[model samples]
Structure formats: C-alpha cells, structure tokens
Target: MESLKYHRLQQRLGYTFVDQKNLQLALTHRSHGATNNERLEFLGDSILNFVIGEALFKKFPEAKEGQLSRLRSQMVKGETLAHLAREFAFGECLVLGEGEMKSGGHRRDSILADTVEAIIGAIYLEAGLDSCRDRLHSWYAERLAALSLETTVKDAKTRLQEHLQSLQKPLPEYNIVDVNGEAHAQLFTVECKIATLSQSATAQASSRREAEKQAAAAVLARLGL
Candidate 1:
C-alpha cells in the first residue's frame, strides 16, 4: 500500500526512482531512524541553490549580483518549498516516527521543505546533474516565468510597511502573543496590528520573525493588497 502511494507521488513528481530505496530514504525523517534524509537534504540544498542561481543568471543577464541573490533566496526559501510540497501532496507520503506522527510532523513546513530537497538529492544520485536540473526546471516553470526585473521580490513585512506608508497610515506593530514547545523547537504566535484598521491579524510559526511575516501577510490579504 505504501509503495503504491509512493508510486503516485513519483508520477506527480515526474521522476521515477531507479532504486525505490532512494525514494523511501528521501521521505524518511530523522525521527524515523538514524539513517534518514538529513544527508540527502544537505546535498539537495546545495544543488537547488546552484541550479536556481544558474537559471537566474541565464534568464536575466542584466540583473545585478544583489538582484540575482535576492531572486534565488526568494525562490529557494523554506516557505516556497513548503508551498511546492503542499502542491505535491507530500504530507501523506512522509515517513516519520511515532512521536512525530502524533505531533503532526508530516504537515510541518520545515519537514516538508527538507523532504523536497531530499528528493532532489535522491534524483541527482540516481541519475545526474542534467536530469536533476531538468526536474527542477519543470517544477519551477511557472514561478520562473513569473520572475521579472521590473519588480523586485520583497518580503511580506517590507511590502506591508511600504503599503501602509503610501496610505498615510502608521507602520504596523508586531507583538508576541504566545510561545510554546521546547526552547530549541519553539512555536511563536505573533499579532500584527495596524492602528488605522480595526481588525488585526495573528499567525504562528517556528520562529518569531516567520510568525511576524505571516501575520503581516495575513493583514495584506485582509486589505486585498
């Protein structure tokens, strides 16, 4: 049954593993056992950065170094990887330990993001850089097409701040409402409040910065920006 599910995931990914064990290893979290996807994730991270950077270099020859760096960062960020993971329905395919399973580890952004990288590494190992690059290009086709030098990719907080400034409203305030879990693996809840607006937005994430960013994004959504 599990193998059948993985087969479906391969179809979705548009790459079939020559050795099924590589696919299984890529999906196995550290919590599952000592032999897990951490090594693959590391390799995949480097490959992703290099491939995306190369693509951006070719796509925008006139772009400055900073612009290329920022573009690559935006494309390879954990949030973007998590979004891709959701699109691929990767949560159901994750292999986690009993504790992690009970705690909804499969749905975690970090886990999903790491799993995506791990799969990339697995593909590189099984085939080669050419095959890995082709897969990445296919995966990021829409996102790559959307890129442009005319508009810079700004983070949610920066966009929110600039938007409010244009409307003659005071900058938004962020407050930490709650913190949960262990020190190393904490969850932070942040509330983003705009004085001019009656409604505020709150979001939770593994870090304060990320939670604040999410809160700001929520406020932007409310304002239809």
Candidate 2:
C-alpha cells in the first residue's frame, strides 16, 4: 500500500517508476525497515551533489570551483531537502512505524531530507541522468535563482566581515560570553560586535562550528546584517 502511494507520487511527477522497490525504499524510514533509506540516502546524496554541482557549474560558468561547491552544498543541505519535501508534500505519504509516527518522524529534518535523497536516487536509477537532471532542476530552478542573488553561502560571519571590510570598518568579533546545556547538547552564546551596534545569539549544536553557525544566524538577525 505504501509502495503504491509512492508510485502514485511518481505518477504525479508524470514519471513512472522503473523500480517500484527503489521508490518504496526511498519512502521507508529506519523505524519502518529492518534496513532503511540511509544507504540509499548516501548514494542519493552523492548523486545530488554531482547533479547540483554540474547544474551550477554550467549555470555560473565563471564561478570558481570552491564557489560552485559552496553553492551546491547550500542547495543540497538538509534544510533545502526538507523544504523540497514540504513542497512535494512527501511527508503526507511517509510510512512511519508507530514510534516514529508518534515522534513526528515524517516532518523531521533527518527523515525528510534522507527521503528526498532516496527519491532522487530512485529517480536516477529509473529514468537515467537526463531525466534526473530535468526533474531535479524543476525543483531547484527557484533555489538557483535565489543563490545567484546571494554573494556566497559564506555564513553570517563572512558576510559581516566582508560588509565591514567593504566599508573599511574593523572586522566583527565573536566572543563566547556564555555556554549552557548538558554535555551532549551544548549551547554557545556568542556576542558579535560590529562597530557601535552589538548583537548576540546562542547556537546549539553537537559541535562548535554548528554552534557558531547558529550564533551567526542570530547575530545576523539581530544586526540585520
């Protein structure tokens, strides 16, 4: 029944599934399958990276390799995938076991993103690269446009530094004023001072970089940077 629903999803794409199991596998969460979409997600992740990378490479022919990679990364990020899932309403058909269903597994970033990758993987396997490229771009066209507007996905700190540098202002500084939370999920409170306006944010992550990103996003919001 779940497989049929996923096939219906493919039909909605106006693309029939070459391998029904692949699409089914894509839809299966770890909580549901003895083995799950993680492996498929891994393959799909690479496929998407390559596909999105190539797309950007051609679209922005003058962009350097690093810039292209950053743009692709931004596009393939979990948040982007989750957004795609929402756009396709894939969550509505996600077949979660009882536990995951109760825990909001269908809407979770990890689940939704992985499912997206798996679906892409299934698409690639079924319809080949041309079809994959076509379908993927239909989703990514807007994202590509938005990315073209942004200078880079270089994060708020970079943007802030660049902004100050362009204006000949001193570099912004991030001071870890406080740290909170248990060992597993620590939150770092960072204060970013840019000229006379001081802004701060707390980022919670499993690692420092993650925390910094969270903090930077906050600082950007606070400073309107």
Best by TM-score: 1
Residue-by-residue lDDT tens digits, candidate 1, 1-225: 998999999999999998999999999998888989999999999999999999999999999998898899889989999999999999999998887898898888989999999999999999999999999999999999999975567779999999989989899999999999854257999999998779899999998999999999999999888
How close to the true structure is residue 219 of candidate 1, measured as C-alpha lDDT?
94
Tens-digit lDDT string for candidate 2 (32-145): 758677777787898899889888988898888878877877898878898988888888787677877886778776678888998887777777888888888888888887
Q: Count the backbone clashes (under 3 Å) in each candidate.
A: 0, 0
lDDT of each: 0.93, 0.74
Candidate 2 ranges beyond 4 A from true positions: 1-4, 145-153, 157-201, 205-211, 219-225
* TM-score of predicted structure 2: 0.73
Superposition error at 74 for model 2 (Å): 2.2
